[model samples]
Target: MRAVILGGIARRVLDELLRNPYRTIELRSARNVLAVEKAMDEALKLFLTYDPIEDVSTGTEGLLADLIEAKQLEMRVPWEESDEREITVCRAKVKLFGLGRVVEVERRERILVAKVRELFPHEMNMG
Candidate 1:
C-alpha cells in the first residue's frame, strides 16, 4: 500500500534513522480510500476480543496501531456481538509517518496519536 507524508516529517525520521540504523520505515498516501476503509472495517472486528463494555476508554491503545501496522486486513465478529446494544465499538484510522519536523500528540486514556515522529511513552526529549 502506497502512502504519503502529510507535510513536514523528514528531519525527524532522518534522526531516528541515525539511532536505529538497521530499522526501515516508509510512508505514502493510500491509493484507494474506499479500500482502506473497507480494510479498517475488517480490522475493527479485532477489537471485540477486548470486550467487557466497562473496558472502553481503557487500555489497548496499541491494539489499533498494532493491527494496522501488523497488517491484519481481515477479521470476524460474532453475530451475537454485532448488535450495538450488546456491544459498542469505537474506532479511528491512524497513519504513522516515519518522520516529521514536529510531532503533535494527545495522550490521556491512551495515545490518541503520535503523528509524524516518535512521541510514545513521553519520557525523554518529549518537548
Candidate 2:
C-alpha cells in the first residue's frame, strides 16, 4: 500500500504512518497535478481524501472544496440506496495527464455519492 499526503495536517499523518512497525506502505507526495498524474500511473489503487475549506454560508465552518470535476474526473451514480435497496455502488474515473500523454483510471466500489448531493445542493444536480 502507498500513502500520498496532499496537505492539511499532512506532516502529522506522515509521522504516524512512518512509525508503522510492519513497513507495509510507501509514503509519497505530489506537489501538483502533473506530479499526481505520474504517481497515478504507477499506482494500483488510488484513494482521494478531502479537507474542507472555509465557507461563508457556514460562518467559519469549512466545506470540502468542489474540485473533483475540475481535476479531470467524473462520477456517475446509476442508483442510490433507499428503503428498497441496502447497498449503493458508485463508479468514479479520473484522467491523468502526462507529458504529451493521457491515461484514464477507473474504479468501481461501494461509495455513497448521494451524500454529495446533500452537502452541495446548490452545486450538484444529479438529475
Off by over 4 Å in 1: 1-69, 84-127
lDDT of each: 0.29, 0.25
Candidate 2, residues 1-127, lDDT tens digits: the string is 2212122223343233324312122222223233234335544222223221111111111112111221333234345643332222222233221101012222212111111111233442211
How many angstroms is residue 70 displaced in model 2 relative to the true structure, after the best TM-score fit?
12
Clashes found in each candidate (C-alpha, N, C closer than 3 A): 6, 0
TM-score of each: 0.18, 0.20
- What lDDT tens digits, residue by residue, belong to model 1 across residues 1-127? 1111121224564345335533333333232222234435454211111222232232322111212432323335577776533322222234332222223333323212222232244332322
All predictions: root-mean-square deviation over Cα? 13.6, 16.9
The 10-residue segment with the lowest total lDDT in model 1: 44-53
